[model samples]
Target chain A: MKSKLIIYTFIICLFLTGCFKENQIEKMGIINARGIDKQEDGLVQASLVLFQFEAQAKDITKLVKGTGNSTKGAINNANLETNFLLDSGKLQIELYGKETAQEGISPYLDTLLRDARVPDTSYMAIGEPTAEDILTVQESGISMNIGQYLHGVIENSASDKLFPKVSLVKFSRLKNDIGVDPILPVFEIKEGIPKITNIGVFQDDKYVGDISIENKILFNLLDESLLSEWLEITLPFEPFKKYKRNSSSSTTEKLHVALNTLRNDSTIRVTDLEDLTFKINLNIEASLLEISNQIKLEDKRVLKLLEKEIEKNIEKKYEELLKKLQEFNSDAMGFGSVYRYSKKGKPLTRAEWRKKYPEVKADFNVNLKIIHHGETF
Target chain B: MKITNVIAPGKRIRAFYLFFIICTVQLGVGIMGAPSYIFGYARQDAWISILIAGVALILILSVIIYILSQYENSDIFGIQVDIFGSFIGKVLGSIYIIYLAMALLSVMLTYIEVVQVFIRPTMPSYVIGGLILILVIYCIWGGVKVIVGVAFLFFILSQWLLILLYDPILRMDWSHLLPVLDASLIELLKGAKASSYTLLGFEILLIIYPYIDNKKEIKLPVFLAIIYSVSTLLITTIISIGYYSLENLRDSEWTVITLFKSASFSFAERLDYIVVMEWMMIVVPNNIFLAWATTYGIKRLYNIQQRKSLYILCSLLLVSISILKYDYMILQFTTIVSNMGFWINCVYPFILATLVFFKKKRSKHKGMNTT
Candidate 1:
């Protein structure tokens, strides 16, 4: 009797297992990328890059667009045009338009946070003018799906340490964290192709300004400790004129130098509490890669002079960038975090830090070491 | 009522299995959300709160073991009967049984709710609840030895999931843990009090004491188990506080599960989904042990057989889980159960241990006078 009961129970369980709603892969529209833009009339528009599985199709992806008052509403509006059920579980990236990002992204991020299906690792970026244009671009020489392609672009840059990787979770963490603001990579149509051109700075959730691509490495050096990479710096020709071995006359006013950085580490300290001043120290170990003016790198004195010049140049540029960020009222460098931790009393609030951020002063110290000038030098 | 239980020699288990039993029972649906709940009070100092709770747990476990040592082959129900006499002891024992039943129901409902939110939203609650209860009934059929075996097996199985926390640990912002000792003493105590929910299940030792073969050696395993469980909670809480900002931590419902959501592998993209499904191994042992305690208590207090009480209690739990389908309703039920569990599991033991101590002293005095 007990064996029979066990058999019956097993059979019942088998039958009950089919009660769950089945979602077949072919019948669902797998959303790879989502883009949101704000319209002039204050409505939200959503553009989704969906993976198409038709064997005969030349392209395996397509874009669907819709408009509504909210992000989810806009997505649901887009859902009406497709035969397959739209599923965002496979979403790899999310894009925001310049205007929409300027308005703020916290409202759109709510749906992402509330939904359990959306992965927190999905990359977040801002389109230069509008998310729809970037999502709908038909660039040549790109055979893969556009969404996948965009994800690869951002992922490569992040891995290379050229741009900070701001995933859905990281973005929210920085936005909500006291004494720190969020930064996102900005994409724009350069000529005919979509490209990540700059790093967008945000005050809270609003896009206030951007750091140009040329300054990306410097920005990264200030942001976090980085691995091996290449950096190009230009110095005054006057400093190295005497050391030039060939005495080659050049019309250029500045000497260009390229260094392959093996490692860069930065530390931020609150040096003065009353003056609200912070001191940033950078330690860089690099191998000389290129030089506009050939100098005797074999000489110890010349190498020391090169290091000193490079340090001074980097320090000057860092001061400029810090001033620019102060102007924009964005503490993307997380100076507030260091200040908050150093103080003993009450925790610093975001609003209080924002008010004090403009008056904050910083001193930059760069220690540059040319470990080796490659096999040539 | 008999004060000492007489068991078949074959039914007894080694004292070492208490480690597995206590550890598995303490780690349930509670640890998944314990970080967020405790973080609400202690902030980054939540680990300190867990440490405080651990020390208190060790003291309480020692006292409970002392009380059990005062009698031979006696469990909580038997000792209560000795101290409070028949009627009051039965009433108190029945209340404990009811608490266990409520705890069992809440665990089932919470797991169902998690499945609904994370995996299949449209699936009915009764299906999951009924399925789990069926497994519990099957396990309970094998008796206490089988329950302990399941606990040991599942404890070994579920420990590998701890390795998944490595990815989240890498992304942690060390600065978030700064400004330590920020929470006041009162707040830290309150945080420790909040952890009582997750730190429960060791109370099972009170009833399962009589079934151990080497009763004298039970202390080492039991203490080790509490330390293992508490340290696990402490580690997860510390990781969560560092991985998420204060505001983000506050917003997250299940911080540990969310931590897994960000972990991606080359072969598997959504690890959280796998973790959620694999969590059944963890949840089943909890249900089995709690169900065993409830039914065993019923059998001891009343004359009803364990099998009959198991079936009736499981059916009632199925009905309750189905009725408490809404998220808010499940949350409310969980709050009520944890509050009740706090008092019965943490506070009541000290009171009972004191009563047992004084009763033994008076009985010794009476015996001396009679001689």
Candidate 2:
């Protein structure tokens, strides 16, 4: 009787297993990238680059555009248009146009963040002209497709210290962290071709403008409190300047100088309630890359002049950037976060930061050290 | 007679009951929310903390086994009464029973909240509560052996569904895990505290100990069950950390559940349905085990029969508590229960071991003096 029951149970199990066989696919529509922009009709225009499965063959990438009042609505509309469901979990990149991002990505981000379908680590970028332009970028000569190209651009920029790897998850944290403003990869269309050029800066959710053209932005910022390793930018020095030469050169000689990032290591000394001074050390390690007017290769006097000029340039840039930050009331440099995290437990909210940031006195000290040159003249 | 009658099971049921107990108790409500909670405190290192917790569980269980072995065939109740005189022993037993009841209530409430919030917002809490209660009653009515057999079947089936989760794991970015040694000590501690849920249901050994035929083999299976649970939790943590990074996992409420939904199978777009469906296999036996434990506790403490009286009392309490407190109040209540259960389960085992040892020492000394 027991043996009979066992066999009977096995048959029932096999039948039940067939009944509940999951309708799972061997391949799924993987979204590689997404672009969001605003339309003239006040709808959010979303373009998705989907990596389509091609059985036994390499995956084919396709673009699908949907429009609605919001990103979620647009995505829903797009889903309705396709036989295959839209899956954003594999999405590696998301591009928001300058105007759309400025309008506020918080709403769109809310939809993605709140939705379980969207992966949290999707890299966020800002596009110029329109997100659609970047999403539709196609070149006849390009070996890799547009989705791969766009992803490659962000990856290359990050590797070159051009911008930070700003994941959607990290953006949300930095969005809320006091004093540390968020930065994203920014793409601009030049001559109708989309290219990621600068880092899009944001104060909370609002676009605060990218870092000025001079100082290279690292994809991940080093702790501003420590004077660790800094980037060294070498340039040519003028002959008339009081400096030593790294090498003998034509009056217009190139200087092989190393410039370290020091404004990053600026100190925030909170003396009293009334005075919060940010003493910036524009400490740069430099040498001559070239010289327009130079003396001898081993002339310490000539090299000093080159170092002084390098010092002056760094200090000037630091001051200008600080002034711009004060003007914009931006804390992207992380002065606010440093203050809040460093000193005790009390954290200043957005309101408190706005009030105190302008009154803050920022002192600049440019320290120059002529470390080495590429070779003797 | 009562004990033998309650423990009787067909040979086939023995394997299934054990499997059911292990899988259901191990999976519980923790799998849904644990990654986020543990991640928040430990940051990326939460996975490390889970592995550490698993080891801690193994050690705790080993100690429990050692204590049980001292009495040979006696269980926690019999040992307690023998060691501490009946009055104090019964009081301690009552506390244990009440603690299990409270824990059962908390797990039931947690499952309800998860279902209401994620699966069905419009569905009443009692729908889940009523369904679960019916299943638990049916399992217990069939007796322990049958329940274990069912658990064994569920465990084997659920393992099949887990293969579908591999797609998301492949896309994991390990770079996001940089700056590894970053979390504050306080945060790591908080993460360890949140891991209490993952380590739940192991305490059911207190009741299940007497039912096992071979006391010697008991240690290995129980230890292996803990190891299995820890391995599952560790895998879940690694996947959550790999899929979302620490920052994202920290902010998410139902991190694992969300991750499951994020993937699309070629045949079906809805992976969340599969997850919720599999969770039924987990929740059913888990709910039944907790109910059985509560009933067992009552039987031991008050000298009530295992059937009819103890089971009915537990059913009434679980169903009413599960139904009546369905809203936000359930959240407040569960936090207290989980916090209390952690103390009762993790620490109480040690206390019993100490008490038993002390009594044995005293008796040995008296015998020596008499000689």
Candidate 3:
């Protein structure tokens, strides 16, 4: 019994000896964001936005740059210039330059996916001109670290239904899924500040092209059910000329209308299997926010006319966006997934879907309901 | 050789604890990656395969219970001795003991690998392996009651981790589950076979049979334990198939843990870290139960003290874990043990049940002839 007590004490001491490696917060270079770019000499350049914790430091964050053949190697090279041990556990965002993304972002994502220490929730995006420029942007208007600022920007936009949230896990899912491609928010430096400008579309892992910001809402509506807060559309003035409250108030050829969408539900179905044709039906509920020209809203006829015009405008825009995606040969909207599941016997391979995606035809059906025309009318 | 064990009344436990013992034991390291293994064969229909495996397990357990019920207060060791004469029975019993040791070692090594990969990489394997073995020895020293108590405690403690799976469930893409009957029947059967490893540990029922008081009441608890474990496996597999794309699911080594990795809270950033550590609670019960089975078999078969054999077995296990350092070696070891366990736990029971039935019938006829 006495000897057993001794052994128990020894075991307790073994655990209490602190044998594992220690990682102090002050000594860890917590990387909040990392940007990758391709150099002219075929080297991978990594720009890391590190959180600075030192009380005496001049800034809340610091930029560390390095060049190597791979992302890990480049990060290692950057480590030599810092006293703190680089840790990627708190990483919030990862960005790739246009060139790097065009080449393919899959190779760069290996470190993120392989490292168990890294969180899978980090947002992924593309830098228009270069990732380094976006990470190193010096702007007086921004008070917080660039990495945190960029994360907040993306998170806000995603919550507002401006774009789909693409985290590391989601990106990998889309990249690996058979019939669908991945998309990322594109950030371009404007006047020494980074601004989300477009949606970067991809064919598999390689960036094919981008969709303009004007079409982001339409893209999202087609992708899934969404509740966007604002939408602007221009319609021919000929339709509403008779309902005008003041006849000569404005001579504009087009009437501009703004809407606050309450809800938008969209569904895509295979219309013709042999012809590879799809029909997209969209149901939208919105309240009028503003109208550039005067129209008699009290008349129920005017409201129906307005809804018809808005639906026509949306259908036209949706078709144009679909055409653009087809021209780019990218299936970012997941139409191929619908096509694959709708068909029977045997699964659709990525190659087969790729060959057939560009030739696929789609018809847009929009149903817009004007719930209310604002408090006045 | 004794056909029945005279277990002291003080050492006997109620049959209700079998639910905890069987459920906790079956839910060890195998579950960490069961989804990926089954998914590789069945894809989106992996849940169907898991359900089939569960039903198969219920059938196997019924056979095992029948075999145990053939003799009063007897375990696998005693029954084997009764059927196969003294020499051959001891040999087969020793082989079963070796299988238990391998299972215990595999569970310990897998936990260590998970720690090295997920938590502390630089921590030596001996430290982890030694700590686990010491805990196992400590629990076993308290005898079967302590081991069962540990299993019961840990089973209740670790259940909260299942709630974290809600995050992954929310993120799941339901469309991934479409085209359900895509996998061929043969492929689905293979998938069910693949789940044999995770669905193991219920076979411990054979070893712990004698200690169970009110043996007539065990059928309900034991079957309930299996149903509970099978449902758990089914839910995890469905979640994994829906949450991850097929290629991604195939690539992830520990799909269940990876599912937890994506669960984030405002206060805590990495839930997987907590889960991988809390998983030690789940693993400890598994180690203790297997170690107890091995030591008990040795004592019953070879007339050796359970304490002496336990110490020797644990020391050897510690040394082996330290030496088997490479990832590939650990992988190979796990594959070998799982394959062996599949046959021992799943197929061997039916054969044993048939042999026991014939042996009982023959003994009754001999008695009648004498009369």
Candidate 4:
């Protein structure tokens, strides 16, 4: 028993020694945002916006800039200037300036992707003016500070189909993908606040253009509902009257109904029957939030007119989105991915899919249903 | 006339020796860069490929068990010699030993590259490489039973890391798995071949077969050990896909490490540092085992008696190659290992199995002719 005890003690000591190490950094500084810029001498100037917590002062936002031949070198240089280590594991946003992003982002991104220290889920954006300029934007009022606000704004807009939520990992993936181009929420300085303007599209390491908010719905059709709230469209008197009078089911001559979007479900299927094409099907369920008090609750004629208007509106938007995407050659909606995934029945390389994507057709079938009605108009 | 027998089969191993075996084989070169490599070919479908590979591995393991069980008192080398003529069997056995040694060297180089790329950039390549090789040599200077025992313990301790990073998986977007069947059949098949890389370490079963003391009941533990390793791979693959889309996964080198960077806890801000530290825990056992295996291979092939000399020689070879000019050698080595190692682990075994089965049939016919 005594011998066994001695052996156990020896093992425990060995395990503890392995666990404990010296020269460890106790206090780690968390960087909220990073700004990347390319210099003329083939070096990179990195500006890291780190938020430090102190007992007496307001949250200190320190701008530490470093220049080096590579991202790691720049980071190490910056660390020399700072009292604490600059860690990016909790980094919220990464802003690449228009010039830097154009030079191609793969080299700069290598540091983030290769190192286990950078957070992959961090929001990535392209900055106008410059990333340093965008990161410097700060003001009082609004929901949060510029960095936090911009982070929320992009995340919020992405869910609302107002902008694309491009993340570090997603950007990394698109950087090499041939058929699809990369998209980042474009951050523009508005007064003293960072504003998410539109999605900046890039093809072959160059910025092409931005996908406007007007065409966001088309992209939304390719994604799951990031926004759960219903959309209410006021009934146009001419269309409402035409449908009400022509329909046979209801006695009411004029009725108004507002549709609240309850759910949006979509699926993309690729078929190679005649031409390479992708078919999109939308399943949207809406509740009637408001209706004319004059219209009876059971008015079939009013319901039919509401359905027709919804269908027509969706179809028109779908065609507009398709045309815009084709014009920009933006496969962000993952029509290209859909085509490739479908062909997994027989897989093709990225080179093969690129040749076939331009000739692909897009067909949309939208089913809109009014599942419920409000208590009062 | 005397037939000399220097050593006998069925030598007993201490329970602790199992840890070395489990750790060395389980904590392999796969952890550093598997997610990125597999993700390149399969994309979001990489996780599915990993899952399929895991199931396939389990089936292959069953076949190995069946063959190993056919001979209770002999090792794989002995069984080969018994099943086929001495000359052909030795040739095949030599090929297997050479493959094992090359794989050991390749894994050592890959591990050194990962450390250079991520952990210690300013540290000289030789120092880091030499340090790891020294650690492996120190452990391997013991014996096979001791190495296997240490591997088992190392494998157990390495699992603690999953608990630390469990919360980070919640943020993973499973939609990354969409359009699951998008790839052509050829692409998926190629992806499956790529996926076999992570599943290759189980081939150690063939080499370690002779040393197991409890022949009748050793199957369950060995099978469970393999399943545990595959399960770890599957979980990590799914988490990687969810964290990074297929497009992003292709660009990254260390998907699992990157996944940890996405993780944060209330107490710890950067979980990746801890993950990297945990990686050391995994690498130690793995390096020691591979080094020991290579040492054993050299000793067996050349009929060398001085085992320590073999250990030192194998360690120096690994350290030298690992420190080779880092530009394209590492990449070339990775590509060779992934591509060639696939055939060695996946294709060569089936070939050997077929030949052995045919030889057995021929010998049986000869016996019948004598009757």
Top-TM-score candidate index:
1
DockQ of predicted model 4: 0.31
DockQ-better candidate, 3 vs 4: 3
Query: What is the i-RMS of every prediction?
Result: 0.8, 7.0, 0.9, 4.3
DockQ of each candidate's interface versus the true one?
0.80, 0.12, 0.75, 0.31
lDDT of 4 by residue, B105-128 (tens): 666666666665655555566665
Which scores better on TM-score, 3 or 4? 3
lDDT of 1 at B198: 90
Each prediction's whole-model lDDT (CA): 0.88, 0.67, 0.89, 0.66
Model 1: per-residue Cα lDDT at residue B253: 84
State the lDDT of candidate 2 residue by residue for B175-211, as single tens digits.
3443355666677767777788767887777678777
List the lowest-lDDT window of 10 residues for candidate 2 chain B: B1-10
**Candidate 1: misplaced stretches above 4 Å?**
A1-17, A158-161, A247-252
Candidate 1 CAPRI-style tier: high
Instruction: Highest DockQ: give the candidate number.
Output: 1
Candidate 3, residues A310-373, lDDT tens digits: the string is 9999999988988999989898888988887889987899999999998999999999999988
A89-205 per-residue lDDT for model 4 (tens digits): 567888888788877777777777666556667888888868878876645645454566667777775355356566776676565554566777777777766776777777645
Model 3: CA > 4 A from native: A1-17, A158-161, A222-228, A241-253, A291-304, A372-374
Better of 1 and 3 by TM-score: 1
